[model samples]
Target chain A: MQLADRIEKRRFVGRELLLWLWMESELFDGTLHTEEHGAFGFWLEKQLVLSAESESTSIKAAAPGLGREAKEALLRGQLPERFAVRISKDDEETSLVLTGDTLALRALKLATVLDKKEEAVIGDLVDELAGRTRGRKKKKAESEEDEETPFYERMSKAAEVEALLGTLYRDFLRLRLDARWDAVVVPTMRQWAAGEDVDADAYRAAKRGKSTKGAKGAKAAKGTRK
Target chain B: MSALSGSLSYSRFFVTLQGRDGTIRSAGSAADGSLPRGFLDRSYEKLLHHAMRPLDADEPESERSGWCVLGDPLDVSLPKERVYLEGFVNLGFRTDKWVIPGAMLRTRLRQAELAYREQVGREKLSRRERAELKEVVTRELRKKLVPSTRAVDLTWSLDEGLVRFFSHTASAMLSMVDLFEKTFGAKLVAESPYTLASRLRGEDDPIALDDEALWEALTPTILVPEGDA
Candidate 1:
């Protein structure tokens, strides 16, 4: 199943960092930056310029019902940092498209926080936004319906899973372990295998809080979060 | 760099927390950022009794004073004894002469961030819940984030050097005047309450220019004398 627009937009932010984390794979837990000198204007310009380097990717930053000049500036220059915004053939690409200024930086930071990339299934963000607009208009008419929907009711179970995956990614990012992929890769593979139809017993055991001990390929699971 | 002539900079501050139930406690910048013992007591002694008159304890008087400055302490009632620490810093007045020390501010903010996270560990949330919580918290932080410790508007002119200060909240301005007076030792001259009242009424009252006018104005509106009524 595909993710929604807000989730995709979040995925877009995570993707920028995820590209590096995916390649490095081993170090995806968490990453924090506390640079006080980095002004909002400075950070936005840096992320945009870096995100735009991809040849095939379309980077955009629109203020939604406002002028587009700020968005255009994000595309103008090469980023001052050494990190290249690499787009690979195997798994697609990651980048940001946003208007210039501290507001863009703030937006990017918030988007990054909300994003959980590796586990999130991708959705067409444009379609999601359109659907939301249509739903909001119609929801008012449905107010007479007895049941009330929780604020987060629309989020699927998969979205919850993806969020956990993101947290794992953030932790790895923070640890900066050289072999982080080894830490996360194997356990994720095991979980996926368990989720599959075959070896249903092993999957059930893991789900029942039995712990995935001695089920074949157990050594690979060591050191990784269960 | 030359320090400005009459400008003042507040090097440090302290806030004493007095709960509605009268549980008085204090917090301030310890030399090394650790909480000092009797902090609340000393601060209260200095600000309330020694410097400004003690705040009246009566219900009506206390209500006019202010809320519990410390706010609800880290809601320990939650599964984790979690607490959030927030304080407003007054960057010096807006004139070019005043400067906010960037390094000091960064250090304090970093400490605040670390303190918050350490108080809330991973066990506090289920794996999935923590992930969603992270996203929400991060988004909120980013939205309200300020790049530098210094957030203020600076304006300078010749006639009346009015350095109007703004901050995340009005309470932040509590020690601002004290800091200025202590460092610069400049006398604060507010218009006498009687003078202000007389001016408003278009008549000069003899009592208008006296310092006691503040106490009188604050005493509560007296009902007209029974004969006058």
Candidate 2:
């Protein structure tokens, strides 16, 4: 197929990715892990939008995914079109709305470093009050650096969030392209979405074993079984 | 959302370079160093060349769009210092369009037509005459009015090959992409699930499975079985 056709066809993968994320977030109790980032806080928050061809359901609450209507929408063949998500790692929280088809992040609010800067400003005031004198040029340079600090910090934080999302997408792809997707993940997801009890521990064990087996097979094929 | 300040909200696009043979290459491959030597100087010249031109009442063009200084739509001077900020090329995409209300235009045209007919001592005007009068009226009205202008900030990280366009509107993005490709001679691919997946998989992993086939064969999971809802 042509590149454009492939891109258009795979757009649905984004909605499925969001749906899987919502399910995993709930099943894992608002925490998900990857080899790179270990465990991080992740959950759907504030808003959730699910839609089929003609009908759509929009839910807004502290945790919209926990509502019964969200599950009902899923059962009715609606996938998440867009939803707000909150992810926290190392006490730094980032919130953004994820659009399914484009996987575009909108209104990404990164953790602010201004409070720390405020403290630093107070310290600078104290230094000035203590009669500490500095060269005019040096002081001007310092002030300029201070002005740029927050922008750089914000960009850094934003890049960090992007990297986290990239890693999460990678993990999702690994499962999605594997046999375990239909064998394990989807069955449990169906049970959970239908308001039926799902054994989280059992699912995790099965998922982990399958992944390990796949890795071993790959290693063996590479002649590195040991 | 402003790049220098305000709450962060933007759309991400991955930049790619197209070769002469029509092959698309990853931005990472092209990003060998910090935008290459004298690249900024060359880009500054291009910026000046394509800088926003305010709509002129005398001109026939009703709409125009181009780059301007970030946070200042009126300032199209695009000084290098204001645009090339610490590894990022920040600029504002500005569009100006003259919008004349239909009712107002009709009223003005009618007045012009009447005045022209009275001056020429004619009770009726031909179709061509009416068209010429309407054009004259529109130009006169444009002289008395200002074109509405919209400016959205865009920041391009030269190192990361990513562009953060502050506005998510489709038209604005399309305009920006067109302007960017024209100005920089590079293509931009908007961030999507497929593109992101391809990038995260890395460029050198030849053993990686075929993405097209994988994605094509995939089916949406049935979260709820039949009659389960």
Candidate 3:
């Protein structure tokens, strides 16, 4: 469904909101699952979890019916080709593992009742991760033990995990927005942009570009010519 | 002159800038250009979070020196209803030698554009021949590495007359702010606004419009708010 439509219906919940978003957003299709056994299980799995944490607080409450296969997928880190999953270690806690573009992540995050400030906070984490990796050169400054270490593990000294959790909490706020972001807001923004007085006209103009396109029709240009 | 020398890959060459307040911003490939200027704001702090460490090579540290923390990405978003690319870096900033030279910058942009066109050419179908080509391009692009939103950089410089730009990967359109800022260190000389259009059917020119005029011409659509559809 169009995110706007979904947003209006108010049917999306935490991990589901993130799952739907990660799968459908412009970036790519991926899954979210929670992994237990801590970081050890996380590494043993084939698929990588985007969030640093193994589980989120709300995983259990959202998906009471989560089965062994799904849980195993999280444990093995095996993600399907076109989906994203979030695995929480606590079975109740939830975190997302999205494989898509920035915009997709933004939408899913925004869908939850996340305020701009929280989003900005997550945006900070993204910036931090992107910055830390920039212009980095790969050389063995340490022994074989360092080589076996996961990349994130190396980042431990730099506090990458802590920073990721900060973003995770911010992301959770966004997940809740899925339950809170009213699809009605789309029309509101469109109405504001058009500077039109009528809500109906704004809604139509926003829904279909007909009004805006027609507004800029030939007559407007010809009238200016005179 | 060149990107920090070492076998740099996508992960190693990037850095995460955390605002003291808490936000995540992305900088481009080391070779592409430096981070955007918004990251340089007071709340921002740079972390050498990841670097590509070669298996067994020794390299000089000075190669990585030009790397400075730019500003946050969100703070420099495009102004409301503007057609312009936001946060372009002024090229004159390179005059100090910390930045790459304009001539070299132009060549890199040109090369990137050529590679993009060549990829399209391999299909033997013009972009217009099939509606899906755009999707293909978009999808493939999503898979590849990207440094930042817009190509090139724009920033505030002490000078008012000259514009400066640090070029990045050549995307569909080269940002006008990048062009103008690189060209003029200061604000536009004229009071009147100018239109930025492609000189040819496909080329993008900077200085097409000052910020004010561009915003007036654009109509906000669902695409902007819901994310690039």
- Most DockQ-accurate candidate: 2
**Which ranges in model 2 have alpha carbons more than 4 Å from their true place?**
A113-149, A211-226, B20-22, B29-38, B120-124, B202-210, B225-229
lDDT of 2 by residue, A1-226 (tens): 7766777877888898899899989999999998789999999999999998899999999999998999989999899999999998887777889888988777776666333444456766777788765444444654455445566677777788888888788777777766667667777777888899989889888776545223333323224211
lDDT tens per residue, model 1, B1-229: 0011111111111233344476533222122333345532343323222221222222122111111111121111211111111222112221111122457445554554555557775334455655554444444443343222222321111112122232323344444444434422232221111211111221232122222322222221111222432
Name the 10 consecutive residues with the lowest summed lDDT in model 3 chain A. A103-112
**lDDT accuracy of residue A61 in candidate 3:** 24
Taken over the whole model, the C-alpha lDDT of each candidate is 0.26, 0.79, 0.27
Comparing 1 and 2 on lDDT, the stronger one:
2
What TM-score does each prediction get for chain A alone?
0.21, 0.77, 0.22
| Model 3 misplaced regions, further than 4 Å | A1-65, A72-97, A100-106, A111-226, B1-229
lDDT of 2 by residue, B92-145 (tens): 999999999999999999888889999999999999999898889889999989
Candidate 1 positional error at A56, Å: 16
**Model 3 alpha-carbon miss at residue A213, Å:** 62
Give the Cα-based TM-score of candidate 3 against the true structure: 0.17
Worst 10 residues of 3 chain B by lDDT: B191-200
In candidate 3, what are the lDDT values of residues B88-206, reduced to their tens digit? 22111111112234575455545555676687776345546434443343334333432222222223222111122223222211333332323322122211001111111112322
